[model samples]
Target: MYRWPFISVVLIIAILLVLAFVLNLSIGEVWLNPFQLFFSENLQSAILISEFRLPRAIAAVLVGSALSLSGLMMQTLFRNPIAGPYVLGISSGSVLGVSLVILGGSIFSAEFLSSNSAIIIAALVGGLAMMFILLMVLKIIKDIMTLLIVGMMFGAFATSVSSILQYFSPGFQVKAFVLWTFGSLSKVDYPQIYWMISFIVLALFFVVLSLKGLNLLTLGTSQLEQFGIKTKRLHFIILLATALLTSSVTAFCGPIGFIGVIVPHISKKILKTSNHWRLMPVSMMIGAFIMLVSEMLTHLPGSGMVLPINSVTAFIGIPFILWILFKPLKNEI
Candidate 1:
């Protein structure tokens, strides 16, 4: 499988992430000289690095990993080359939960502190609840395409409900909800990064350990059963993993999309095999790189207007999905 090349690609992606991290620490509306970030007395630069750049950079990398891994697992589970984090409406559910907090938060402004934890807790509840519903639907439907459609419809329903809520919301509350839907890596601060990092690390450790099972599944259901694989148990495990990672990103970074969907396709094409061992880590690196690239696009210096990270990601993810749909191979990874 040319393991050396796979490792080389990951190393190169990691190096690129380091470079982006340094560059991200430097650039801002008040440009800090790259050299001056370290070599000069620019306290403003130091503060920017500590406050804005560092958190955003860390969030970019973490969100990217989470989304990418979730997508990879979904594709493997659904046997759909294009399945991503969005396929299950998990992120939309999280969005709905956030909307509840934003719109209704001011109703208790005298006790806003109580609402902060409520917001995140509500998001987790929404996401896991949706996941549970999807699992039950999958059991009944027994058709992959049907399950996919059900997820889409469920997400649409959540969005509709959220829209109705926003209609009656205060102006600032609506505005806050809108911005949160668009997705932003810069919004995550230092206080939250520790939990985000710790959770993602632990989740990914289990996911990576499942690589062997994932690899075996690529041989098809008959082989997997022959190998004593409990199809339903594994199914739930992967879905739970997907839910955990997706919920984490949606909770913290507001549903950063595309990394989970398209990076796995790119990984499959690059690795030229369905083995999870090769695809998993590579997908993680590619996801992070794509995120760094999109983050730069969002803050492009000359544009005079910042673009949403979703804008750039949709551009990348949509094309890959369309390509997969319009022209497919008998064995799609």
Candidate 2:
């Protein structure tokens, strides 16, 4: 089995993240040295850095880390290797929320949904609602497989509703909703990035507090109970943290996928341990690194065409997923 010391893994991923961050900022329409651009006297270069590229790069890091952490926590909570915000329908809930605002013309005014705040609020509300429902279902359903099925049903329901809404929506509103569904990093600006940072920071605090509880959880509820851990409360706090992390990303980035699932698996494989202490930071750094690289790929230098960030991730993700499905699990992390 491949393994590295915890510090070495973190340091290596951190360095990669830094390089990828700089590389992401340097790509796009015109290749410019980002560090040079920052100090350059050219107002045009300054505007491009400060107003556009910088925010997009930061948003990529933020979205990647949030989604990765969310996936890790959910996998731990469910004790399922394949569990994630996207697979479990949490992102679908955010989509439902946004749909109500953008596609539900009879309910929410187009002018009102036009504001970024409204869209963000809608996403958070919808994601939290789904989280709450899943928590309730957890209380009644002891089977993890059944719980996952319920989550998929909820996601399907949300998607079906969004489709129906789209069917009746004005062409402009539908187009706007469709574009948002494509997912984006450039769509997030400075103000939205500030909000995303706040949400992720708060979620990370909860995660730090829940670290021991999460470790206990991986050992099973009986072990946690024997250790005097309050399982239900811990579950709530962890799920809440996941919801906050996932909702913020989906709200701003339009539900980017695969990072949450892939990063954790890769982290586990490299670390060869289940300790949350090591798993958390490594997963985050790896996620951010992947996102930055994905962003750079989406905007290849000298290519006037820019691909949707979601499509790039899917291209990276689908192969990894197929590998996981077919790969031998005798040494599974």
Candidate 3:
């Protein structure tokens, strides 16, 4: 009975994913008929479908999958329903990195560092630096609450630095920074997509290996110890994997949110299972579907103006968050 329901949910999500993919490709600035996408003689339409929409769709899938998985891992690690990638401030670290390059370049008149490649590098470096610091602190701290507090402090520090840079930045630099923070799937190109996918795959490999540990962890640290699971070591591995996933998405897509926090809950609610083996794959699918929907909403069928992907996600995510807050207390996973 349980297996059938889980399989049904997977099948439903898979179908929606396919439909979303088709709609994403077909409903851009110029709508292309599904049948004619491959056979269309219009060169401009073909280019739009192949060159532009395809990359954005691919980005949505990868970013959604990475953020959802990362958020699930975090929620599991902290045993908190609300914990998410952005909640830990890793995304802020990336923002600070990008701000330093964009705003700093404008302030110092350094044209060379303002390029897209430089910005990506700076973001990656800043995110990894923050991850390293958090991992180091995790070694000294055993309490999950204390670790969360430390992560918040890191985020606050990064935000303060970003604020200072923004205050000193020129109009154009500030504008650029603001736009990046709004988040986007359209910014990813083919080369960046390749790297993002590679990083996600590697991080997910680590996650798959640790599934049994994750399942044991849900039973509490004592139970984990009883099972011969090295809780500290496993926590390190989970955090490291999460950092890799979160930082890569933030670096490439500029800190997309809500999908991470929302998708896992949606998956758990649907699957009614705490087993990581089941939860992980379901969360990935639901996350990707939500992102595709968000991407579709960003460009309404007839709307000429493109909305920020972040705004659409906020609309979808905030309601769920409020529900979680006000609902009667229950086991989250």
Best by TM-score, which number?
A: 3
Global lDDT scores for all candidate models: 0.77, 0.84, 0.87
Residue 133 in candidate 3, Cα distance off native in Å: 0.6
| Cα RMSD for predicted model 3 | 1.7
Q: Which segments of model 2 are wrong by more than 4 Å?
A: 106-112, 138-146, 220-223, 331-333
- From the highest TM-score down, the ranking of the candidates is 3, 2, 1
Steric clashes per prediction:
0, 0, 0
Q: Per-residue CA lDDT of candidate 1, range 1-333, in tens? A: 354576677778789878877776666566667766777576766777888887988888888878998999888877777788878899888878887777756554533622545666777778878888988986776445577788899999999988887887778778777887788877678777887777687777668667777887776662455787766566667777788888877887777777798888888777787878878888888888788778877876954476788888888778877887787854442
Model 1, residue 283: distance off in Å is 0.6
Error of 2 at 285 (Å): 0.5
Report the error of model 2 at residue 168, Å. 1.5
Off by over 4 Å in 3: 1-4, 328-333
- Which of the two, 1 or 3, has more TM-score? 3
Q: How accurate is candidate 3 locally (lDDT)?
A: 0.87
- Arranged by lDDT with the best first, the candidates are 3, 2, 1
Candidate 1: give the clashing pairs.
none
Error of 3 at 182 (Å): 0.4
